[model samples]
Target: MKTPEPNACLDRLYRETGLTLRQFAQDVNRLGTERGTPLKYREPSVYQWLQGHMPREAVRPLILEALARRLHRPVTSSEAGFPSSPDQLKQPASTVQGLIHLGREDMDPSRRAVLGTGLFSVALTIPGWPDVVGRMKAIKTDPQRRIGQSEVQAVSAMTDRLSDLDGEFGGRYARPMAAAFLVNTVAPYLKASASSETRKSMMSAASFLCYLTGWMAVDEGAHGRAQEYYVKGLELAGASGDRRAYCHILRGMSVQAANLGHGTPAVRLANAAAEVSPESSPRMRAFLAGQQAHSYALAGEPTNAWNSLREAERAVNQAEGQLGTFGGFSSATLAYCTAEVRHALGDAKGSVKSLKEHFPLRDSTDTQRSKLLFSSLLAERQLEIGHLEAACATWNTVLDDYPALHSGRVDEKVAKIRTLLSPYRANSIARQTAERSRELLVK
Candidate 1:
């Protein structure tokens, strides 16, 4: 490694982080990639930066975010001897920038380790959600070029195509393609000139893509990055005045929080979705109410949970008059959430009934990965209720589907099953099932 003089500021900052130079460099590269600019810095590179050499311009913001996270405080560019303005750089400055950043970073394989490692944060992620606000800013389009309805259609078309890919193949294969679409294609249109109507369509489509990217992030086991994308998607949807997209984004974020066990924030985000979309169709309300019930169950508030679930059923019924008005709600989604909430509330029988309701509907759909997920959910619930053989059957279902998927989300679920089976090593079926799961998981 090339040597540089021992420097004052860099040494002090490095010491404050308490990470060795190699570790610091790894973090810097990971954070840099997370900010849309992948870096290949090493210990020697850090020494050079500390010895008064300037780092690349894009890397400065990443250094700030990484340092702030490491030291648990805001980091200024000036403190790092970078030329950029010395303001908050930990968070992305704009929704567009953040979305673009997430797209670029998610495309890198090296940074995926960070994604796997820091998928949950109870304290930092949940409480940081902003209060109710609408349409905070307007998107400025580039006047140098003209964009038309064709461009907007293309974005939505690509989003639809990618959505199908995610359903069949899993997000591991689709996330980078989606990110590439956003970074290399959709991003330009977001900044290009378009008619007022076309602009809203573009923004809404972009928001939808960003939200899908967030979902993909979750599938790839990057829940922290997923949260950021959801926030940006919400803002973009809000900016476009797309109530449907905004509500959907909020619901997605709520699911992430609840999955991470941040129950209160999950509840707040779900309510925000409902509150912000007053004109929501009955179908939409059904979906949102179900989401709220999920969070309430996670929060251990059975009254609120059941109340929301009942409201969801009523909304679903009300929407029944309008054919195809289920919007985002389906018989499958309602039952899935019901099973989830019941399991969380420790209603084993209720969970089994709801899971039964869900399986038939979900099986009719083409997504095998979703089957792996809900099957594991049912397996865990069955095990909890002392149905060891039933749990083993569910485990077999998951293992059977496991080979077809390359999804981190499914991997995480099966991993939990492995842990769940550990205590039952004495049972021959449980031991054999766990052993088979381990072998398949390793492959």
Candidate 2:
């Protein structure tokens, strides 16, 4: 069966308040800013909501908050046409509705938060083995237009393009594009005619795009929404029999957890992905192992971390294939993970060594974020090794990359650098750069 559309109640509330659609959007953005997300909503987004669209679960509460403040009364979920249970992507046959709702909210600048608000909790990432591995052989679908290989290929190509954009500039740049494509282009196709094989292929493709959306949500710092995307993507992936995508999505969640400093969840997700991973792709295996290593390091299990790193190295050496999507544990990714592991184990100099020796330096495209990250870490590591001048010099790259990116992840690196340099503020170079970072951040 096709997915259902979200119902609407926002129009009535707006009419009662006598605010223009534009004014209503402005109010939402204003309220969001005061609460720290600094949303960028405008008239069209609000118009869509008025026309029966549901905002994302995260945005709905804030939206109601905005409306209540404006109307001088309490605005509840029912009045806004939102579901009482806002644990998104969990309800049955709710995938399409959830996607549409999330799409509208993501596209609206007024609902934009700094991203990654919900900490990556184990509750969100770890699932029972039965739930994840439960696979359906064939979907019973018979849409009207007759879904074909061509449609599946189109979605795949679009997903690849979005992934490329993600690598180049990060999720902030790729998110709206993914959301719009899924909503306008893919949604109709999903709801329309197709045979079992076509449906399976299309479902897998849809699942992949959803995974991409979740990754971008994490990159842009919307952890709760990211988890929602992962859950729905996993459901679709299972039905499509796309074990690879399923494993990859789980690994993606692990990456989020690792970055959020929730080591146990990160390790749990990685281990789950490893258990379900197909043996055909050595590169994928390597990726999962590397992920495990990073998580173990985060968890302060140095022995496990070392063992996992060895396993990762072995798998990377054996890997021989055309690289898969999700970056395929590329050389650069391996180096990054290796550095991360070392850093987690408190080996500042070793992290620096691995970073410089193994870090991908050729064909510099779509890796500015990682490159800048390594440089920034190098600065910190240099400080750890008592090379203050070298540390200061290494920071130049980070400062250079700062203005070119719009990632919340990168903004976080900036914040850390500020704290790291505080004790040395008496030094001329340190004070100067600190001042410079302060000014740039203010802008």
Estimated TM-score for each candidate: 0.75, 0.75
lDDT of 1 at 304: 98
For candidate 2, the TM-score is 0.75
lDDT of 1 at 60: 65
At residue 76, give the lDDT of candidate 2: 70
Q: How accurate is candidate 2 locally (lDDT)?
A: 0.75
Give the candidate number with the greatest lDDT.
1
Model 2 misplacement above 4 A: 1-93, 114-116, 125-144, 360-366
Cα lDDT for residue 98, model 2?
67
